[model samples]
Structures are given as C-alpha cells and as structure tokens.
Target: MFESLGAFVDHLRAQGKLVDIDEELSPDYEVAAAVRLIDQRLGKAVLCRKVRGCGMPVVANILARRDLLRLAFASPNDPTEEYLRRIGGSLPPEVVRAAPVHEVVHDGDFDVAKLLPLLLHHEKDAARYISSGVTVSRDPQTGLRGMGIYRIQVCGPRELTISIGSPPVSDFLAKANATGKPLPVAIAIGLEPLSYFASVVPVAAGVDKFDAAGTLRGAPVPLVAARTQPVEVYAEAEIVLEGEMLPNTQREDGPVGESTGYYHAGRSWAARLTAVTHRAHPFYYALVPFAAENTLLMGVTREADLLAALRRKFPSVRRVSLTQGSVAMLAIIQAAPASKEEATAMVRAALEGSMQVKTAILVDADVDPHDLNDVQWALSTRFQADRDLLVLRDLPGSPIDPTATNRRTAKLGLDATRPADQAEAFMRIALDPAARRRVEEILARLT
Candidate 1:
C-alpha cells in the first residue's frame, strides 16, 4: 500500500491509470468537466498541473475504479471481505511530533478560497466546495474520535459551510451544540487510500476511526496534533485545516449535486477556520459529486461493511454487492439458501445491515451479485410479485434520495432464488463443451 497520496499517484502513473494535464484549467467548471470526461472514456485519475488561480496541482478520479480499491486493500481474491476483517480489528494511531503537513503553516489572516483549488462541480453549486476533506472531531462526552467525509463550501474568506449529515460527526456536533460550545474540528485533505476508506466507514459510536484506518492498512496510522485545535490529523496528509464548528450557526449550503444525481437543497453549519497547514508542495484532491469516483468511494466500502454484517447473521451469504450507479441504494446478495424462508431472511438481513440500501435482492450462489444483468435476469425469471416481493414502508432513508418523502421511503426486498422443486425448470441452457471449443478456436484464429 502507498504511504501517501503522492505515492499513490506515482503508482497509478506507472500503471497507466493516471493522466497528467499540463494545460491550465479553471476550478469553476473546466476541471470538473475534464474529470467527468476522463471517467466516462478512460476511467483514469487526472492530475491538472496548473489551476487558473491556485498554485497546487488538482487531482481527481483517484477512486474511480473498484480495482484501485482492491489494490489498496492488497487483496486480489476478496477485497471487500478482507477490508471488513481488517477494519474490524483496531490499531491505535501513533501520535508523532514532526509531520509533513506542518512544513508550511498559515495561521490567521489567510483566505481559504485563495489557498486551495476548490472546485465548483455543478452548475447550481453555490460555491467552490471541498468535497473530499475528511473532517475529524471528538465527542465531548466520551472523547471518542470520529471522522467523516463532509462537503465544505467556501462561504467566506475564513469561513466555510460544512454538511454534517452522516454519523458520528453529526451526533458529535449535536452534543457539542447542546453544551453551547463550538465543536473543535480538523479537516485532513488528500489522504492515502486506507485512511480515506476508514473515514467513510459507519463505525459504531465510541470507535476511533483513526484506529480503524490503521487496521485497514495493517499498521498504525501516524498522527500529529493540530496547531490551532486540540485535534489530531494524519501526519502524512497533504493539507490540514484546524477549525471549530460554531454553535447555533447555520447557513444556506446546497443546491449542489449530490451522489444521488440530484441537487440537494439544504442548510449547513459554519466552521470558522483558525489555521491552514500543508506541505511546501501539495496536491489538492477534488472529488466531483455525482461522479464515478465519489460514488465508488462512498458505495464500495459501505458494501463491504454491509457484507460483513450480513455474513455474521447468515453464514450462507456467499457474496454481496451494491450497485455503483445507484449510490449504494440497491443491494444484491448471492447466498446458498437451504429453503425459500432462508432466502427471504437473507434479504431482510441485508436491509437491516445497510440502511442506505433501499432495494435488496437475494439470488442463488450460481448468480453473480456484482453483475447487474445477472441479478436482473434472476429478478425477471425467478421473482414472483405476490410471493417473493416484500415492501417495508415509512422506513428511514437517505436525505439525498430524491424519491424519499420527508426523509423516509419504502424499501423493497425480492427473493429471486429459484425454488427447490423447480430447479431443472430454471436451469439455464448451455452449449456443449466440444461445440464451444470449436467456436472458440475459429474466433481465436479470426482475431
């Protein structure tokens, strides 16, 4: 695994998975447009060497492919399961004195907008947003550290609006606000793959995310205390912003595009920036909302977490996959069901395991959960509306879901596993081995 973002970039470049753009691009829309194009065509990470205003280079689409994540986990066979097992074990972070992020510190009288190459990804986006910053905060009650990826919109010279919709940051902020005290926070930007993966994991309350990150990397993550706040940040992070979320402060946040491919209109609490620290030269990471990188990073790890949870409940669950295009709203479970009841139970277990999954489908071990076509075929052939479909209404749902009414939506579960009695009827037609070999030989010769 790479120790830093720069190292990861170098790895990608060597593998021909990264593209370097020398032309100057505006952070307004040009950079985002290029990133989307790259993702659509080549699926490679882009390094914009020159931004119109900012000095640092901008990096996008780092986590655009699931294979990249597989490489990061260092597991070729079962990356998701490996990631789950790794994160399940905790390794406390090592607090160090000297760190790379402290090489250049800008305390007081610095504008965040002028410092970072924040990108305006969508047309209706209110301002340039820091879409990839991992916001770190500690619970005031238990002193448990929490980390989450939140949208930080540059609202003013030294002020930013941060969306705290996810846990346990949201819960931490609420507790701090209840005490009428500003919540101390440190935002670490441009982190390595393991730290980034751990930041997004929905760990239970009181679990330290830094430990989870370290465990994922098979080592302890080095940390350094923030210069301005009483918080710890990744020692090798490219940039660190120390600040506090002001109590009882709210601002108009988004009309910006979210992972759900819809503009989420809402207000966010403000974080007053106290200091900005970074390496002498750093790469500004840009995660475009609703894009492949953003969706993959958010969805892939979540699927792993769900899989881990489901496997504990139902050992028959062979594999689990969340559809990437759906932002993890749809979950497919490949399970070896003893009976129809077990299949239905697996579907329910999947839904309970991951709240973001609005639709859960269970198929036999023969079906590939990752293949949308395979899952759809099973749904079309084996699923019965009356007997197989289970709909749960008025369930808690994602705020970004456009179809949800009042942050609540209906969840659907389909047991698509073929019945035991009708196994032969559902068997797929296959070509004879000798006939297939003859066609392959001819195709190979033609190629």
Candidate 2:
C-alpha cells in the first residue's frame, strides 16, 4: 500500500483517478464550485493547483470513490468486512520524538490567515471554515485518544467554533468543561485517506482509533508530538493545528453546511486555536462538505459497528451493508440460517449500537445485501407492508439527522432472513455455473 499522501496521489494518477486543475480559480466560489460539482457528480478525487486567495492548492473529493477505497484496503475481499475484522480492537500508536510537523511552528502572535486556506464554501456561509479538520484529542479521565472529523467554522484568524454534538468525544469534552480545563486537541490535514477515515471510526469510548489505521495498513502509525500543544500527531500529515476546546466558551457555530446536504441550525461552543503548524510545502485537503461519500462513510461505520454488536447475539450473521444516500439512517444485513427469533434479535441489536439506524434489514445468505436492487426485490417478493415492516419510535436521532425533531425519529426493520433448513420456498436458484460462464463468454465476444 502507498505510505504517504503524495504516493497515494501518484497511485491515483497512475489509475487516472486524480484530476489536476492548473486554472486560477477563486476560493470564494469558482474553486469551491468545481470541487462541489466534481465531488457531488463524479465522485472522484480532484486537486486544484491554484486558488484565488489561498497560497496553497486545495484537494477535495479524494475519498469519494470506491476505487480509492479499494486502494486504501488493498485486499481482494470486501473492504468493509476486511476493515472491521482487521481493526475491531487495537492498541497505541508509535510516537516519534520529532518530525516535519514539529520542525515548523507558530507560537504566540501568529496569524493563521497567512498560513492556511480557510475557504468560504457557500454563498450564505457565515465565514471561512477548515472543512477538512480531523480533530485529535484524548479522554481526560480514561486517557483514551479520540479522533473524529467534524466541522470547525472560523470566527477569527485564530478562533473557530466546533460542533461535536452528543458523541463520545463530545461527552469527554463535556467533562473537561465541567472542571474548567480546556481540552487539548490536534487537527491533522492531508494525511493518508485510511488515516483520515480511521479518525471517524466509532470505537469504544476512550479506545484509540489509530489502532484501526494500523490494522488496516498492517503496521503501526508513526506519530510525532505537536510543538504548540500537549498532543501527538501523524507525522506523515502535511498540516497540523494545535488548539484547545475552551471551557464554557460559546459562539454561533453552524449555518455553515454539513454532510446532511442542508444548513442545519447553529450552536455556540468555545474553541481556541492556540498555534498553527505545518510543513514547508503542505497540501491541504478541502472537502465538498455535503457530499454523499461522507454520508456513506458514516453509514458504513454504523453498519460495521452494528455487525460487531449483532455477532454476539446472532453469530450466524455473515454480511451487512448500510444503504448509500440515507442521510445515515438505513441498513441491510445478510446472514446464514439462524432461527427466525434470532433474525428479529439481530435487527434490534443493530439499532441499539447505532441509534441512527432508522431501517434494519435481515436477509438470507444467498441475498447480496450490498446490491440494493436484489435486496429490494426480496422485500417486494417475500414481504407485505403490514407483516414485514417493523418500526421503532422515540429512538435517538443521530446528530446528522435533519428530521430528528429533537432526536425522536421512527425506525424500520425487515426480517428477510429465511427459516433454518427450510429451502422449500427460500432456496436461491441460478443457471449452472459452467453454462453461465459460457453465456458470459459469448456475450463478451458480441458486445
């Protein structure tokens, strides 16, 4: 696998996946418009070599494609299951004494507007935002590290308000707020895409996320200490920001766009940018904020985590997939024959793990859960509305949920799994293997 961001870019280029734009596009809308449309439409990685206001080129939509995802995995089998099995539980990262991020530092009286590309995305957006900020922090009590991708809107050259919502990391910061202590954090940008995605995993509270990265890469992630803050960072990252979440500090955070494709309500929270640090030639990653790929990442995380939770109750569960473009609410799971009771239990168990799972699907092993058409066909053929549909009300609506209505949203479950050893009606059929291969070969010649 490619070790660094540049190597990954080279890999993408070799595969003709990266689009390098040399045009002088303005950061206000020109550059952002291309990023938004390319990311939302093509779903491929793009690199803008020139920006109107910023000194650096902005790269977005890198993680938008499954080809990049496959490269990140580098495995033949499905990356989702491969990822889940590889990094379900992991250990600490390898901390280096010093590296590139520490070589350049911004101390007191530093001006961020001169260094980073804090671009304004939308017309109504309040101000510029570091759209790709990957926050790195530690749990105060448990001392466990927390890495997540969240929005940070710029309030000043050095200040931005954060929206962490009610997540585990948020809860940890909440505790820090009660004690009058500011939470130390490191924001890393332009790291490996695997590292970036690992930052967003929903690990056990206080459990490290880098372990997942290490597991995916088959090696420990090299880390370096930040000069301005008491936190460690991935040394390979092009840029790093040292900051602290302020105690009882509040500012109007949102009205900036989110992954939900809507400018939801804004809240106030205090986030202090103590110092900005980066390499001599840093490549900044700017995401088209509301892209479906981001939503898919979140949905996949919830699905994998749900599979882990359901395995304890229904070990027969073999495969699962959360549907794309759900706003992160629905899922489909494929399992071998267990009991009918076990199928129902698996659905309920998944909901408990991810409250955002508004729809859970339990399908027999023959069904390809990842393919939406096949799963929907199963629903249409085997299911009737009143009998097959299962709904749960008053469940916690996850933060990204727009129709949350105060986190009270309805959930649905489909028991599409077949009865054990009962192949009479549920048996899957297909043409003979050799005969199908011959047909495909003939079709290939003609087409």
Among the numbered candidates, top TM-score falls to 1
> What lDDT would each prediction earn against the true structure?
0.86, 0.75
Model 2 poorest 10 in a row by lDDT:
292-301
Model 2 lDDT, full chain set: 0.75
The runs of at least 3 residues in candidate 1 whose Cα sits more than 4 Å from the true structure, single-residue gaps closed, are 429-447
- lDDT of the structure predicted as candidate 1: 0.86
lDDT by residue for model 1 (71-96), tens: 67767866677766676788899999
TM of each candidate vs. truth: 0.91, 0.87
Pairs that clash in candidate 2: 249-270, 251-269
| TM-score attained by model 2 | 0.87
Candidate 2's C-alpha runs over 4 A off are 108-110, 139-144, 166-172, 336-353, 416-447
